[model samples]
Target: MDLEATKNLSASHTIGNYILKSKLGESSFSTVWKAENKITGGEVAAKQVYLSKLNKNLRNCLDCELNFLSSVNHPNIIRLLDVFEINLGMMFTEALLLDMVLRKSIWSSSASIMLEILKQTVIYMLSVSIIFHFCKSEYLQSQDECCVFLVLEFCSGGNLASYLQQHGRVQEKIAKRFTQQMGDGLKILQSHHIIHRDLKPENILLSGKESDVVLKIADFGLSRVLPDNHVETVCGSPFYMAPEVLQFQRYDCKVDMWSVGVILFELLNGYPPFRGRTNFQNIKSSSCLPFSQHILPGLHPDCVDICSRLLSANPVQRLSFDEFYHHKFLRIKGVGKYHGQ
Candidate 1:
């Protein structure tokens, strides 16, 4: 893998039968590109992972993601298309092909408009979680470098991180819409015994079609399935880390709720709930970010309560999926509001 040039393979080249057209995104180990499948005349996203340049043991982050993708199928989850391991020069690199989702402009001038957008995004996440419950593994192809590739749904809408950063702060109604969707997504994952170890706005993606504003949860690099006993890995973002996760204790799906709190806080406050001057400060004090009480006064009372419970210091004390589903925040009773309507 050409470290410098491979940064945005999505824009530069195609993996196999796909014709690369534009760059979608890039991370330290992988790059996502938008392309057209020459065979079917369909659009797809290609994620190029540079495994040879990573740890000699072959960091299985991509593999883990592939494994999860193979096992789970969801409408909100990006679908894996194919895997490519072509000769870069002297060695081979890994790339995952996926469907691309289109992005739309976020309008925050009005609560009603934002509410509609957030509602659609959450609905998309709910679809993904629903599909995850009955997932089946399928073989695409294997890489020579011991890495794997997956094909997923194409969401042209892009990721939530850029959306939040661009919009700064979302209105209360809009934030609640997003929170419901995110919470529903997590509830689905938890129901199926899947844990989105890393739950952040960046990992959440949007759909391309304007009529279908589906928000997908993408990038399972740090995700893991909890065994019957549960997992003890100390992974996830510093800002969204649960207190128990920070303490290096055995944790379960509740960690995702902790992340949900952080995301909700950011949606309302424009920044992470636990922001510090430096990375060290963020990690050191992140576990104790006072739930939305002080930072989110303008938010609805029920919304604040939900965020507080999700951000509880004790994982066990956090709200469960049932409680979250029936929370007052999601229970909009009037016609002007959204809920069962």
Candidate 2:
């Protein structure tokens, strides 16, 4: 629960040539750390996970993450450098050396610098392949405690949540910059058949510069590879989730489109489309609101139209990924204007 206690428990733990320096992050099933390797004298992000803590199904999910990272060759996605086995109940993942960018943001002096970092991050994501992998070694040790560790790119900027908190709501000009880059990133993902089920401000991490803000769609725990036909999963955050998901209907990548719509809406509206007194009720009735009425009168009608189609409850009627690129909102935002009209 406390930092000191965490050090006490994992202080003696070692994975091959890397010595655990200090814990950087800890979740219910895994812990990440900043460590220096004695063999290479280089710093690396080490994620230690207890596979025994995961249920059978979730253990399989962890495998999905490992397999995805290992095989994927994407600048935006985290790289898996090496893996280590710890006794029978634990395993440590040594990811490609990367710093905690969130902590780096603490040194940033202004919001402009932070936005620049976010801009570069989104660009990096555009150049890589979204691959999938599976790690069975942890599961082999202990099914009950199995877990997967993700070592990602070190963006000097913090997450979108912290960026928003520090800078508050962004100006229209700034939001357009973000929307353009984010739209580009989403298009790349769609090309690869990966749907980022969770697409919210928090998941959209910044690099650490106002003009250099590059956005990366992180945290694919709820994401799924579309089958030849269609896959169904009733999962995602209440506020960013699509109406079809909330209704428990069969949906495709359109769910992700819905999330993007919500984000764009928030960028202009200064709040998520759905917020309720309680999360339980919020999930039940959030996506039903009409954006046109709630949106600011100054927003271009085309922008509102594109967002409206994206938020449509009917997946069939929702804006397709291709259509999104050519939408009036994207055009007004200067997304695809370079090539032609």
TM-score of every model versus the real structure: 0.71, 0.70
lDDT of each: 0.65, 0.63
lDDT (Cα, tens digit) per residue for candidate 2, span 174-231 = 6666777777777656766767777888777676467777776665555656667765
Give a tens-digit lDDT track for model 1, residues 196-263.
Answer: 88889889987756344566777777766667886777777777787777777888878887888788
* lDDT assessment of candidate 1: 0.65
TM-score of 2: 0.70
Ten residues in sequence with the least summed lDDT for candidate 1: 93-102
Show model 1 residue runs off by greater than 4 Å: 1-12, 53-64, 83-147, 208-212, 278-280, 283-289, 333-341
Best by lDDT: 1
